[model samples]
Target: MFTRTLLCVSLSAAAMPLMADTVWMKNGDRLTGTIRLLDGGKLLLETDYGGSIPLSWSKIATLQSDHELLVKENQITGERAKSLLASDEGKVTLANGDTPKTVELASIKQIMKPKPFVEDFLWKGNVDVAMDYKRAESDTDDYDVDLKTQARHGKWRHNATVDYNRELRNDVVSTDNWGTEYALDRFLDEQWFWQGRLEYKRDKIEDLARERTVGTGPGYQFWDNELGALSVAGLLNRTDYEYADGEKDNFYAISMRWDYNRYLVGKTFELFSTGEVGKPLASVADYSLDAEIGLRYKVTDWASLNMKASKDQVSGSDGDKDETRYTVGFGVGW
Candidate 1:
């Protein structure tokens, strides 16, 4: 009797259908696993036999999800629904139980897995650090570090960035600088947004001790595609400055910021440029400009090599000069 019972249980378990997801390749290969994320022209899959595998978007012929997903089409913003594979040749079924909407595989922009409401609001951060040294004649050392974090919930997004740099000469600290910026953006629609930001920094070499700025304005997303993106915003800002010589002043200014990014080598490499200009209402000649250009080469599924050059310029009562800085750092993102 015991033998019979064991056999019955084993048969039931074996007869149970698999709940795992599936992916079909253009070459007629079938992968059975859980679909993790589809981003940057690549699809991630977690399998029982092999570990996580990244399949190029061009190679994926069909996608079948075991759970609901938030999908974005080339024309539509965001929709939540179930999906199936192989229902058609070059389309995916919406599976809404009504008139199924067939979306062209090429028109699908992004796919996100569903998570708990609170988990969607959790922050994700990336950090990079680099150092340099010169040992002949005059000893000098330089350091650069940056940390950035962002979170998205519904139509609102929050971002924070912090960076610090220092130079040492003969074991003494010569240049010490650090800054942090916090920004909040609320999306009004597909291409427009309202933005606010606060920033603080200090420079010792420019006869400047500390600077604080607060700004907010409207912004626009000109184009966002698989290849590149561009965004520009204008802000009304109030800046306060304190120098090492015990002089302090504040001014109202107009500021403009722009950022551009392009993906090269099909997500393996990235090129980016960003800049900001500010002019004080008291005097137009007294202005500030900050700009940076950088490239990041993806090394793994989560890490990259980063290199950047930036120029900081200010001509005002407290300082008048330009500082150029270069850095090479290793960064990781999630």
Candidate 2:
């Protein structure tokens, strides 16, 4: 009889009973319950009216149920009915004539978002062996040893950077420079943001000068949590400088930035302040100011340890100068 009708359709597909998967994590979050056991590594979901939700499984990555169960039992019963209507005996309800109360359960406040950046999309670069001490004015004491490398990626969301430098100047062991920058960002509502950047530079002791810059901007992200976001941005820049002696210069600049992110011991801390101002294209010449301060430390998700202290002062020309640079670094892919 067709082998007993294929053994009664394989025992009715093994007596049907299976549908539970949807856990996805690593920071983007999504759940659907029904694990019931995993132990040490965590995971005990069961959730479908019959609650129970213990998680962790290395912050899950995947687990998609065959047909159901992946977090949606009426959105966990509307978050347990909005935590029992924000409790206080669920605001006691029993108006007149009859009594039927059993709604207590409110003490709400569970908000999550912002995790999963375990180095999300980063590809760092580093190399620095320093010993530079110089006393200028007539140049007498000088020391050198400088090499650089840099690479960065998203979670800046979009970024690109390149750098290079070889030491020893006044004593003329010449050659020092390389620079590149590319950036693009967009996030319009969660505060507001929009950005664009493009830069290029080549400096071989100043005279071989080559520079280019383009910028666009608008940013204002009052603040965002999980320890990051506090912004201010405004930019408009255009510059071109080419000189091998046959001089040429064109300028226009205006910039600003103030940004920060937090986390202490485990690392991850960033702070920033920036400024720029320059103007002169046709004449009516006069305006220049530049500033900076930056810091970063993140041991790993990829790798990081950075420090920066900078200053550049220039105004009107003549005898105007002020400069300082200090950097300690390490960084790698995310």
Candidate 3:
């Protein structure tokens, strides 16, 4: 009985590789791992020994996967397959039950594991905090916190963000502000969507004490993938502003908003920018622009070091405001 148990355990260990996804290279190399996703001509494989490795789609001779995945072809729609079977060079067969379909790998646009249920979604976000303290001649303290998150399910996507900043120099408060925003997008097609947004901001040290905005418009998603994403929208907004002196102004505005991010060097570094520019119709403000650009260096899978510069400007208001800030901080992302 002891000899039989040992033989069974050894056989099970030897059979483990058969269950894993695999890719064969033209140079006669074989890799066994869990296939993560394919995007932008790169296939990501999660390996026990090497972590996540990205292989060039062009260099792969053949591949197979044991997990059900959604495979898109020619940048069009996709089909779900129970597993992938290696066929000839540069080809794969999608095994679904009794009916199997073979397709050229070069025509495959993207491949990703599908969520188990319709209610499942993909969500990612990050939070960054920056603080500075100095004790020389004068004491200075500055704190900035920014949070952003987004979730997508089926045709609907949700986004929310919050920002807070405070600075004190020589025990005197120089800046204090906070803002929160939420937006929802409903995709009409592959690249078009409708977006509705609401925003509110408050400043304790600026002439503009409070601001609120509501807007809706059409947006275009340039592209979104594991590497990065870019989208732009045009909006018509109703905005209300209150001054510190108890004065209020309301106006209608047309604005353009953009959000973009790109990952580099195997996703170890990211460059991102997001902002909105608007022109008010009633002359409440000649033009208003709020924008931020930042870079992040991934220290680990979930931790990062980031540097950001942002500008907020408003002209032709009762109290014109213009401010620029720079921050260096650490963040956690998922």
lDDT of 3 at 149: 99
lDDT of 1 by residue, 219-265 (tens): 99786544556889999998888878888888899989987887654
* Candidate 3 residue lDDT tens string, 242-309: 99999999999999999999876556678999999999999788999999999999887789999999
Q: How do the candidates rank by TM-score, highest first?
A: 3, 1, 2
Residue 41, model 2: lDDT of 44
Over 1-334, each residue of candidate 2 has an lDDT whose tens digit, in order, gives 4325334533553487644444545464556654433333455555676455656555554343332111212212212111110112112121222442333212111212222322345443333333445667643322222222223233344545555545565566554666666767565556666878787766666553676779788877675443344666777777676766766766676766544444332224455454455554434225545444556665544455666665544444332334455656554433
Instruction: Say which prediction, candidate 2 or candidate 3, comes out ahead on lDDT.
Output: 3
Regions of model 2 farther than 4 Å from truth: 1-219, 233-255, 260-273, 276-287, 298-306, 327-334
lDDT of 3: 0.88
Regions more than 4 Å wrong, model 3: 1-18, 23-31, 37-43, 48-119
Whole-model lDDT, candidate 1?
0.75
**lDDT by candidate, in order shown:** 0.75, 0.47, 0.88
63: Cα error in model 1, Å: 3.7
Candidate number that wins on lDDT, 1 or 2: 1
TM-score of each: 0.72, 0.27, 0.76
Report the error of model 2 at residue 190, Å.
8.8
